[model samples]
Target: MRRYCLAAFLLLVLAAPAHAQAPAASLPKVAVFDFELFDTSLQGETDGPRTDEHDRLLRAGDQIRKGLAESGRYAIVDIAPVNAAAHEKNLQACGGCDVQLAQQLGADLAVTGVVQKVSNLILNMNIYMRNARTGHIVASMSADLRGNTDESWTRTASWLLRNRLLAPDFGRPQ
Candidate 1:
């Protein structure tokens, strides 16, 4: 009878499920940089770069940061420090500068984008997400926009976030 009781206790212990661990308390941090503008519009007879276009690109960056933060999967790191560091390091257009900025800000991921305007009617918004530690691009998406207006740019960015960045399977190991 004693041996049977011991055997039953061992069997129950072996069949029981192991304890489940709690989820992480904090989300991963991401630093999103301003979307650079590469305007290729034909130089007018006497005109220069359009300041409005630059402003729109800057707004797009803010939109991206907000969108990612709202997703609840990541914590958006403040960009002011990253921008200051970039300026001090003269990191503009430098290779791996985005990653360097993210690392400095103690972020797990970094995002960078470019708005290429070929003309008033043709443009492209390209975004890249990289691992700050490895400096490897984890995701990339591009949207060919038809109009170079604020509404068109905003719409394109929203579509990219929905279809690529915030998709259900996004960030899963392939």
Candidate 2:
């Protein structure tokens, strides 16, 4: 009886699956493009372009990239290839440009942002995440900013990340 019981226990142990020791799956790679600036402050006016606002939008893009990378849910792919492809293809206005760029970088996902400013006191930031393979938007988030200072821009980016992108229930289909 002892021998039979021991044999049964050994058989069960050998047949059991070993899922606990399995390695964690790799995070998906995401390519984040620079935020495009559309400043309407001088609309219907003769004022020159606001280079300072343009530069600030560019900095916002970098902050977004850094935040996503630090989240550990995604691997941030470098944007050099994306920039090169955008310039070569004149994809600045193309709707699917971001998806194309992400595919070129071998990324699984793509992120694009837009900063639209009507004046120094009123602005909006929009961010979109898309599937590189299917070209479908997986998630979209935006924040309305009231101030024109550097602190306001940085805070908006962080708020978007915390409240939308990195949220526990983010990207779920309704």
Candidate 3:
């Protein structure tokens, strides 16, 4: 018993400073890209009805971006400037859109997503965050938002932020 207790105390004493000296982690700066719209085509047969679905997805993406940016953890840059700039550079999609361009415009991370239907009225999203300089996907998430309304938008945004940006391990040591 005495040997065990002494060993435990010595271990704790040695580990304390390492724990206390660990530097606080900083939140990575993120820029959100306009979400890709899939399942939202106003086709020959699905034209009229698809308009509502398309609009809902567009709004949801906007709301999610806004909510995530409100956290102040990310240096959120609007997609308008990025898109206009990308057009000038002849980049196709935002993800394939150049990281060097993004970094030169000042962003550490670039976030992009897609809003599509996984089921009836269930909007599913696949979001990705890439390290701008390295082009590595640092984080990714999938979520199902079942309806298109203010409430649904709010819920989806909250879930996205919690799971992707503010995850418990987000600021933790690897």
Which residue pairs overlap in candidate 1's backbone?
none
**TM-score of each candidate structure, all chains considered together:** 0.78, 0.77, 0.62
Candidate closer to the true structure by lDDT (higher is better), 1 or 3: 1
Q: Which pairs clash in model 3?
A: none
Residues 38-143 of candidate 1: C-alpha lDDT, one tens digit per residue: 7777852236667888788789989999998888767889979668665444233678988988999898888888888787899999999888888888898899
Clashing pairs for model 2 are none
> Which lDDT tens digits does candidate 2 get at residues 47-163?
655677667778888988888777766778888855866545423468787788889898888887887788778999998888888888889998999977888888998899889
The 0-to-1 C-alpha lDDT of every candidate, in the order given, reads 0.81, 0.78, 0.62
lDDT of 1 at 11: 97
* TM-score attained by model 1: 0.78
Better of 2 and 3 by TM-score: 2
- Model 2 alpha-carbon miss at residue 109, Å: 1.0
Quick one: RMSD of model 3?
Answer: 10.1
